[model samples]
Target chain A: MVLIYIDHSEKEIKKSSHEAISYGAAIAKQLGCSAEALLLGTVNDDLTALGKLGASKVHQLNNESLNNFDAKVHASLIATAATNLNAEVIVFAHNINGKAIAPAVAVKLDAGIVTGACSLPDLQNGFEVTKTVFSGKAFAHIKIETPKKVIAINQNSFGIQNFEASATVVEMTLPIPAASVKVTNVNKIIGEIPLTEANLVVSGGRGLKGPENWGILLDLAKALGAATACSRPVSDSDWRPHHEHVGQTGIQIAPNLYIAIGISGAIQHLAGVNRSKTIVVINKDPEAPFFKAADYGVVGDAFEVVPALTAAISKMKHNE
Target chain B: MNILVCISKTPDTTAKIAFTEGNTKFDENGVQWIINPYDEWYSLVRAIEIKEKDPTTNIHLITVGGPEAEPIIRKALALGGDEAIRVNSNSNDSYVIAQQIAAIAKQGSYDLIMTGKETIDYNSACIGSMLSAILDLPYVSLANHLEVNGNTASVQREIEGGEETNEVILPMIISCQKGMAEQRIPNMRGIMAARTKPLKVVEPLATNAHTSIKEFSLPPSKTGVKLIAPDQMDELVKLLKEEAKVI
Candidate 1:
């Protein structure tokens, strides 16, 4: 069976998990097996809706203790569940949680794992999987010889398809191990889009000037319903929170469309976001390295160009 | 309060990455290495925090790499780790690295194993997890907030689209992400102290690697940006509809 991990926070389901279900289901169909879902912790959403994403059965471990992400305990529980269910293939969304948990689970099961998987397995060739390497700089085709396998699919790698019907929600139980590590306290970024799963992102850099001028980036981000990001310098300078930094030293992302404004594309920054499907750069410096890597470039000041772009977008919506 | 902070030496984020002949090896010719950024969060900061709380608490840094990685390891030491250990072996794969770390963690019986959420180079984020699995311990990944009390740990994590808090026991692995602790720079005293700290070198344990790098290559350069005149707002809209297809 193909088992997909449905990642959630609190009771709300993560959007990426839906994509994971779709991908897992398609793969299951290809393998001529049932695609089942394994949801940990307590979730408020209808577990049966996973059927729309191609799950035949949703195995939910709705324990209150499982709600918090304990990677060690989580891996142990998942390993036990996979073994009991006889799951040959396991899948997770290649987001923060998945990135952290998948490797541990792979170790527990002694399964060959592929992270940042961008496509379905090529089962024709010894279960070969294609995954992004070098921060989306390229792809490497990997073949897993192990009987068991784990794959963490990058968000937006597959489109979610809805089908008619409901999938069975089967509650299952696994032995939860006592946690060895204790969490002392937590400090979280107040409000912002989860960079890993954001589809559209508006990123700025040193060129944005002081943090006060950040309004331009935020304005553009709001207009496009996109998340806001910044270069390392912006974050280091405290123009934006460190969480908003997207670069090699910052958060690595693979958004669909990434707009870089007032940023000089250093290779470090590129390493973090080179996987983005489309890149738009706006900088007055014609020699800015980012322009070379952008699908679209505007040789203008972000201060003037961003407002114009936002206005144009709003006006276009009005005309529509 | 003994703490183990795991770190790795990886290619600097700004290095012009290239693959060796036939793509089997990563071209290290001109690549400058740096301490894996994640380790800075979970290892250095957490180590500093623990040190501040209890001056006697020792934070030791460890990595599985070659002699060339020593300088970067020193940089980590400079960051605040009391001492460092360099496992004398090339990090062939995550499993191999995990074995080395597991061996070290076992011998040390560290009260906690902390590292970054994931390394920027391999981008695996697997070591902490694998180590925990090998040790049969609980782990928390992508922890933004962490509270260590005696032997128990409670963490706030950003998973998926929201945040969830988890409480677990100690001697477990925790891979830190953003907000775990503030980034710190080594002061003069810390830098001087780091110079005098012990840096032990040990041979790596035997490992069975399950994966290998077949090749490395850069992504194709994007097409030059297309520009629309400043006043061509309507044209831009038309182009979005007819050309970009995003509208």
Candidate 2:
């Protein structure tokens, strides 16, 4: 069995879980085994429906103590389940939660592990997985030598594919160990879509001038129904909240479309969003290094270009 | 309280990334090295702040690398650590590196163990958790704000969208990130003092890595940017819709 750890928060499943499911299912097909999902925490989503994403079995591990993510607890439970089931492969979404837990789980199971894996393993020859290295600057194909293997798939890399099967929900019971670390408080950002979950992102930077000029960026984001982000300088200067910052030091996002406006393409900044599928850089400076990495470049001031682009998108939406 | 902080030496964030030896190894030529930002700016600084509050608290730094990592380790010591450890062996495998750190960490009776969430180079983000598992310690990762309160600690960790505060008692591991502390530069006095600090180089334990790198490849570069004039908003939108299909 290939056990996929389903990641969730606030009673909702993250899209990354779907990718993990699909990826696990693909790997299971390669290994001629079954794909199973392990979901913990307080998710309200229907567990059985997860089969559509690609799991033959969905294991729901629930306890009052499992309300918040405790890496130790999660790792222990996952390792136990993987062991009990004699799982050939274990999978995680490689999101924040996965990064925190997968390593420990691997160590517990004494399994060879690979994180940030971008593609499915090449099992024909051996258990080899390709993963991002050097902060998205390059890729490395890693061969896991251990019999039991764990892999955390990079988000937005392996896509979702519907598996025409209905998964049976397995009510898993594991005594939740007393957590040494307790979540004292949770302050969640409401209303706005989280940058991590956003498929489309509109980000701004120092070139936008100041906080007063941010209306145009927000307007564009609103028009496109996309999440808004800012550069490290913008967040550091208090022009935007720290959570909106995306860079090497801040939140890293891999949206389907990342529109970077007025942000100089510093390597630190690029490290965060370089994994984005299609990057659109709008800047007045033709020499800005960002243009070299951008798929679409607009040599114009964001002040004028953004509002106009927003209006065009809004108009196009209205026409549609 | 003794705190063990794990530090890593990585290429400067702004350095151009390239491969040498036929894409099998990182090209270190002309690359500037720095103490990974998360370790220097957050993990070590937060440790320093804790030690400042309780002067009795001791901070020990550890790095797993060859002699190339010594300068970076010294830079970390200059921040405020009392002593340091340099693992003699260096490998591309993170498991080997984490294993070496764990070996030294096991020898010390520490109330706290901290490390950067991930190195910018590999972005493995696993050392703290790996260490926690190897030592069977509780861990809270990506802590943006950490405060020591007696033997227990309060840490504000960055979650997916927001932040959550986690409380842990003594003898826990944590991975630090930005927003944990203000970055501090080593003053001339501290730099001079770092030279005299005790830096014990220990031989690596016999450990086998579970994974090995097969090969490396760079992402295909952008074919070329389709530059559009500022006034061509409609055309740009059309391209995004019809050509890119991302809008």
Candidate 3:
């Protein structure tokens, strides 16, 4: 059996979990086995609807403590579920939570593990999986020799697919491990589109000149219903919060469309956003390194180009 | 208080990645190695900051690699680590490396252990958590801020859409990122002192790796960019709407 950890937030299941479920289902089909899902905490989303993502059953451990993620506790619970089910392969979405717990669970199960896996395993001769390495600059094919295997699928790498099936939901009562880490507070940025789940992202750099000039970027983001991000130096300079920083040293996102304005596209910054499906760069310098990586380029001053783009997008929306 | 900081040597960020031996091995011929930026800037520097705050604290650096990694360890010592430990092995498997670190950590009984969030080369982000599991201690990943008082530690890490502040007792493992501490450069005096620092080499515990690399490949090169005139805003909008369909 293939077991997938269904990642969720406080209110609902995460968008990346659907992709994990689909990936697991495809692996199950290849192995001629069943695909199941393990959900922790109490989620408001309908568990049965997850079947469309390809899981045949949903194993839920509804505990209040499980809501606030603790890596040790989560690893123990998932390891227990995997052992009980005698699963051959386990899957997780390579998100913040998955990155924290997957390795520990892999240690517990003594399973060969691969994180940041970008493609499915080739089982024709041996079980080999391809994963991104060197911070997304290259790929490496890894062969797993262990009988049990664990994989963390990269976000946005596997597209989610829906199938016609009804999954049976089962409630599990297990001994909850004591959490050594205690949550003192949770400060959240609500209302805006989250960078992790946003399909389109508009990011800026020092080229915006100062924080006061951020209104145009916000206007573009609002008009497109996209998230806002900035380069590392912008965050370091306090022009934006650290959470809005996206680069090798900051949050890594894989949105469908990434629009970079005034950023020079340093290699460090590219390491974080290079996974975006399409890149559009707007900068005054024609020789900016980012242009080399962009799918679409516009050589112009941000002061003039941004307002025009925003107005054009807003007008297009009105026409729609 | 005794703290253990794990570090790794990796190809420089600008190094050209290549393969050898029918694409089955990493080409190390012309690659320049350095202490991974995550390890140097966040993990080790944070440990140094804690030691500087408390005169009673001692910082020890540890890495698992062959002789080629000693220079990297010396660079870390110059940044303010008091001592170094090199586990004699050249394994790329994270599990094996964790087991070795766990053994050393168990013997030392250090108050805290730390490492970078992930190495740039492999980008596993697994060693710290795996060590925590083996040592049966609390673990935290992507710690942006950390404060230690007596036997307790307060850490703040990034979540999906927010920040989660956590408090854990001593004998914990943390993987650090940008906000943990600022990067430090070694001065001439510090660089001279690092030469005399004691670096102990130890044998690794018996272990086996469950995964092996089959080959290395590069991502397909990007197609050259299509430039549009600045005044061609309508044309850009039309392409996005009709061609790319992202909007």
Q: Which candidate has the highest DockQ of all?
A: 2
Query: What fraction of the true Cα-Cα contacts (under 8 Å, chains A to B) does candidate 1 also have?
Result: 0.45
Could you give candidate 1's per-residue lDDT for residues A1-320 as a string of tens digits? Answer: 99999888757888899999999999899899999999888888988888999999999886887765666667778888998999999999987778777887888787888888887888775787777765666667676767889999987878798999689998897767775444444444456677777888999888878988988789878877788889988998888877788887668887778889889998878888887777878889889988778777778877788888889878877877
List candidate 2 segments past 4 Å from native: none
Over A187-213, each residue of candidate 3 has an lDDT whose tens digit, in order, gives: 889897879888999999999999999
Docking class of 3: medium
Query: What do the candidate models score in CA lDDT, each in turn?
Result: 0.79, 0.90, 0.92
Clash pairs of candidate 2? none
Global Cα lDDT for candidate 1: 0.79
Give the better candidate number (1 or 2) by TM-score.
2
Candidate 3 ranges with C-alpha deviation above 4 Å: none
Error of 2 at B190 (Å): 0.6
Ranking of predictions according to DockQ: 2, 3, 1
User: Which rank order by lDDT, best down to worst?
Assistant: 3, 2, 1
Q: Write the per-residue lDDT of candidate 1 for residues B1-247, one digit (tens) a residue.
A: 7888988887776666677778767788988887877788555787688788879788888988889988877777887788889999995578888989889888886878888877776676678778877887777777777777887767776654355677776767777876777776767876777777899999988777766555455556666677756556556556655675544
Least lDDT summed over 10 consecutive residues: which range in candidate 1 chain A? A180-189
